[model samples]
Target: MSDFGLGVSGLAAMFALMILRMPVGMAMLAVGYFGIVIMNGDRSANALLVTEAFSATANYSLTVIPLFILMGNIASATGFSRRLYEAAFAWVGGLRGGLASASIVGCAAFSAVSGSSVATAVTIGKVALPEMKRFGYSDALATGSIAAGGTLGFLIPPSTGFVLYAILTEESIGQLFMAGILPGLLLTALFMITVTLVTLRNPEAGPRGAAVSWPERMRAVLRAAPLLAIILTSIGGIYFGVFTPVEAAGIGAGLIILMALVMGKLPWGVLTDAVLDTVRTTAMLYLIIIGASVLNPFLALTQVPATLGEGLTSLGLGPYGVLLAIVVIYLLLGMFMDGLAMLVVTIPIFFPIMTGLGFDPIWFGVVAVILIEMGMITPPVGLNVFVVKSVAKDVPMSTIFRGVLPFWFAMAACLLLIVVFPQIAVMIPQAMFR
Candidate 1:
């Protein structure tokens, strides 16, 4: 077969393995190994795999992933999630659909500290689901809000997705973090708007609510102060060049551990669990990185993405047209693929195309993350949605899916706004760099 044909075959086999429920890293590794062997025999394949494994694993930039993951895991174990929820609830729980809105706000805050979408979903779900259910909120509303809100885990700073994007595209992680700020806030605004409208239209899902006492609200805010400090220090420091991304992550993780110790949240067992979780997650991500190393070069050899990009450029499509096309493709793929796997598989191909088309890599990274965030709440393969459903086992999957639709629309609208006015994503980063 032609080299191009070999690439195509490799892709088909990868997807088929995915369909059979194989792990994403294993699927990629398997396809990559066989594809190399088929095209150039056994010795060539082993040589490629050996080299890819060492180089990808030993990458210095990759160190940021585990540090960030350790930061998140420590934060999770330190009682910060509860504090975030309590703070948001105290301030916002007085509005209509207050608890639900609080859930989203809490999810956003939690996401600032935690990078995994499923972790955000499950962690916040444990805290907010019971409260919402007790307050007579519908299963759909409770499950949907948490699921959709959890997608912000990556859209916000200190995100694994952002880290990966930076490493892949060779953009400054600090600049990308700054670029995500407005877009992340826009998404939060959109989700809150969606929640308010839904509650107003159907009071059954969320009845009118009372306000909180100023004193209690202040106390809640105080409880959340440590987290706010960590977020600001990590993200703000990076933006201002006070520290590099890995250094910021280490600082954040250290602060979180200190807070946990002070608050009596980190007993010996809890500390052990936090460390173990971080190690496991970091190990899993490293495996995927190695697989991507083997796979990315093969995909590049196909030249399909470059050809398609050239075709689009040759068609005289404007930047907006190219951007729109990319979003549409992500939406279609989101239906079938896990976001991380999709990102790992597509980014090597798409990043070059995007840059070749004159889009800024940093801007495209945020935009790509927004699309991935949407996928986190999208159906069939929506990881966040599934997490919510798992937590709220009593809630029907259909109800959760239906409830998620409005938030999906809100995310889509946010994506459109970012595309129409690039400044929304670029302003903070540019200002910081300047």
Candidate 2:
């Protein structure tokens, strides 16, 4: 069979394994290794496997993964996430559909510290779900807001999605982080607008809570100040070139731990659990990275990316048209596959096409992350929807899915805006570098 055909078969096999309940990393790894052995030789495959595994695990830059994960896990343990929710609630809870809006705001804030969508959804959902339910918020709006807001974790600064993208694409992590900031905030605003429209259309869906006193609002803000400071210091430091991504992650993790300790919020057991969770998450990420490392070379050897890029370019679709097609493909894949799995599998094929079309890598990274975020809340496989479901157990899965539909369109609008005006994704990164 032709090399390109073999590559296609390898991908098919990987998906089949995934469907059979094999882990994503292992599925990719198994296919990649066997594909290499068939295409090259056993010696080459063995050497590649050993080298990629060791290098991916030992790389200093990868340390950022664990540190950032630790920061997020500790932030959750220390009740920082709850405080953020309270602070946002204090300001917005009086508005129509305000509790739901506050959940979005709080999720955005928590996302700064927690890079995982699941983490953001679970943590914020725990805090906001009960409050929204108590205040007579509809199940759909309440659950939808949390699920959609959780997606911000992937688009906001300190994002694991950006970190993984940077590692894969060889783009600067800091630049990607900066590029995400404006788009992230923009999407957050769009989500808030969606909530307002929803509440307006059906006043019974969301009843406003009593207005918080100015003094209470001030106190809530003050209480959440330290968490906000950590976000600004870590993410802000990266933008200002005051710290590298790794250094920022370390500092953020250390500060979070310190704050938790000082507040006596992080007991020994909680600290230990945080550390273990970080280790597990970091390991999982490394496995995926290593799998991608192996799969990339196999795909390269097969010349699939080059062939795909050339085929698309030859279609006379123009660059924008080709990009739109790619975006559509991602949206479809996202409905069935895990986001990171989709990224690791497809980027090798698409990144070259994007760059060859003269698109900026950093901007593309932001766009790609946003697409992945959409998948997190999109249909049957929407992981964030499930996470929200887990928290709002009383709510039906169908209800949660129904809730995210409007926000899903809001995301689509955000994506469209960024596509038409690429500056939304690149302007901050450019200024930061300049």
Question: How accurate locally, in lDDT, is each candidate?
Answer: 0.84, 0.92
lDDT (C-alpha) at residue 344 in model 1: 86
lDDT for model 2, on a 0 to 1 scale?
A: 0.92
* lDDT of each residue in 1-434, candidate 1, tens digit only: 76777787888999999999998888898888877777668898899999999988887777777777777777777768888999999998878899989999998888888777878888888999998888889888888899999998888887788877876667888888778788888889899999999998898898545578999999999989988899889888888789987888888888888888887888899889988888888888888777887887677776656776787777776877777777888998898888888888878878887887788888889889989888887878888888888899988888999989999999989988888898999999889988
- The stretch of ten residues in a row with the least summed lDDT in candidate 1 is 299-308
Structural similarity to truth (TM-score) of each candidate? 0.96, 0.99
CA displacement after TM-score superposition, residue 61 of candidate 2 (Å) = 1.7
Instruction: Look at candidate 2 and tell me the lDDT of residue 346.
Output: 84
**Tens digits of lDDT, candidate 2, 140-166:** 999999999999999998898988898
RMSD of 1: 1.5
State the lDDT at 26 in candidate 2: 92
Report each candidate's C-alpha RMSD, comma-separated, in the order given.
1.5, 0.8
